[model samples]
Target: MSRPPSNTHDLTFYNGHWYVPSPPIVAVLMMPLAYLVGGKNISTADFSMFFSASNAVLVFLILNKLVDRQWIKLPRKSILWLVLLFAFGTPHLWVGISGRFWFVSQILTVTFLALSVFASFKSWSPWIVGFFIGLSVSARPNGLMSWPFVFAIAMQVMREDGQTIDLKKMFAWSFKSAIPILIAVLSLLWYNHARFDNYFDFGYVTIDGDPVVVQNAKTHGLFSTYYIPYNLRVMFLYLPEIHPDGPWPFLPSGAGMNIFLTTPALIYLVRRYEGRWWILGAWAAVFFNFALLIMYHNTGKDQFGYRYILDALTPLTVLLAVSLGKKIPWHFILFVVLSIIINLYGANWFMNG
Candidate 1:
């Protein structure tokens, strides 16, 4: 017998969530195949499957490019191990289908970062650079916050091989890269205006005139005044919690485990790769997350663990993969296994919860 249509708002389904719809726009763009198989029932969890899978593929490609560049190298076995690790290690890979925007945004954001890295290595046309940057911003408005980091990287590139920046060349490059950003901003404005009659309505921002409430809404609960200190204490002490009615399984509690466990390799990379372009990218990722946390805390509505920060996980993963290839022995292989185990446990916890 055909089952009755389930409640769309059930945690298992997509219809129950509350957020601006911009993320769905990007999710649909990235995974048109989801629409074909699940049609309109493509719940947030369903989209997460697509997003996480896509991210896995992109991470491999990005790593391949990095390997070829000699930034890091690994044996075939190690490469296999690393790939497996990333594919299974992160919790998002396993339980990300809960209809969260973080998985999709993270994939898009990381892809943009990879493209930017590629562009920095080659002499790409300004239009191309601009387009990618614009796409990055469109994927998430917070992406615009990374512009300074991008500029810093570009400046570093100009100083390539100890050479000085050529003013004319720099101007031309900067102008070209600005094109996509301008387009993205204008497009975002147009989208907002169409939906909310303001170029910057951002949905949640319109809930209340109070900046605190609006800002907290954006983080989904990680940085609210009450939750921030509480969560931070948990994270610092290595304690994980589970909330029955939380957005996702084991939230706030298991979520901290995710950040704490994965961040060590990232920290190691930053210190080891200091002054390198990759290090700058890592710093950008950190800056982006910290800024979001601060914004969320100021807003005072702590709910989720600021899960939105997951958007930066891609750059972090890439940085770790590359950096591990350098310092730890067979690091890729070992890390991958660890990541898979962690993700598996997290997923299992979510399913049971």
Candidate 2:
């Protein structure tokens, strides 16, 4: 299934886009392969293809664990669901084809999320858990937001099994996990220092090479103020402006609306599935909503709705999968089908546009 051309301008950060510098070394570990294959100046399509492949592999690994654990079972006719979910969740159709770094981060974030959940169920060494969590943080700064949930879940696991909390054990785990994360962070800092002379610079600050202060100014103010309110309105109310060339021709634009318009089966799944799994869902939802609030407060274009928070999609999908196991009401199934149609139409419009 080929997607329609994007209307947004291509973003070429490597070509002297000062503030919009190259991705961190940690994030672009695959660039060497890309460069070798394409010899620099790789097409956006190439990048998307690489990202999609990487993401697919990671998604499969994570999903396989769930299937193995019997927490969820893949259905014979579930291929459509998988295709649709992956298509919609991918950044290629939403953020323009050039945003491969974001897609990679999303994949890494989801992988971390799955590992975190896996860790909660088993009695793993603190060091191992820390390593997974730290890797997640290294993938994207936003990974930090999920730490509270991870910690809580780990604590729950300990308490549920009647293990006394040992501060010393916890500290040891923290130190062990911190080592890998520290190395990654240090590497990132070193790259930033070498590139921009600032250890904290993470390329976002360069947004087109303007000074951080200037970019900050452009990202916030009266003009961008309505973005937050607009995002909130669309996210909860399911109203978006129609994109002339968007994924859905009949509905309002923005990807965030999909959350509300998702299949009723999924919604029911969320409502019915309660327990340790619910904790994961809740954590993802809370962090996503928090991220939306932050994005709303800040100024930036909201092209694909709440896609900036797409990193949470995997956990949400897992929750939905778990929920689908319960008896689904017929009316709810109807609602879900309708929502799927709407989402598909919207996705088509987006790709075509």
Q: Estimate each model's TM-score.
A: 0.69, 0.65
Q: What is the C-alpha local distance difference test score of candidate 2? A: 0.52
Clash counts per candidate, in order, are 15, 18
lDDT of 1 by residue, 127-169 (tens): 7766766777777666665554455556665575476777786
User: Least accurate stretch of 10 residues (summed lDDT) in model 2?
Assistant: 7-16
Query: lDDT score, residue 287, model 1?
Result: 72
Task: Show model 2 residue runs off by greater than 4 Å.
Answer: 1-27, 41-101, 115-132, 152-168, 201-206, 209-230, 241-248, 251-258, 262-266, 269-285, 288-302, 322-325, 328-340
The Cα local distance difference test for each model comes to: 0.55, 0.52
TM-score of 2: 0.65
Candidate 2 shows a clash count of 18
Runs in model 1 deviating more than 4 A are: 1-24, 27-48, 73-82, 94-96, 99-103, 119-123, 147-164, 205-238, 241-258, 262-267, 297-306, 325-327, 330-335
User: For candidate 1, what is the total of clashing residue pairs?
Assistant: 15
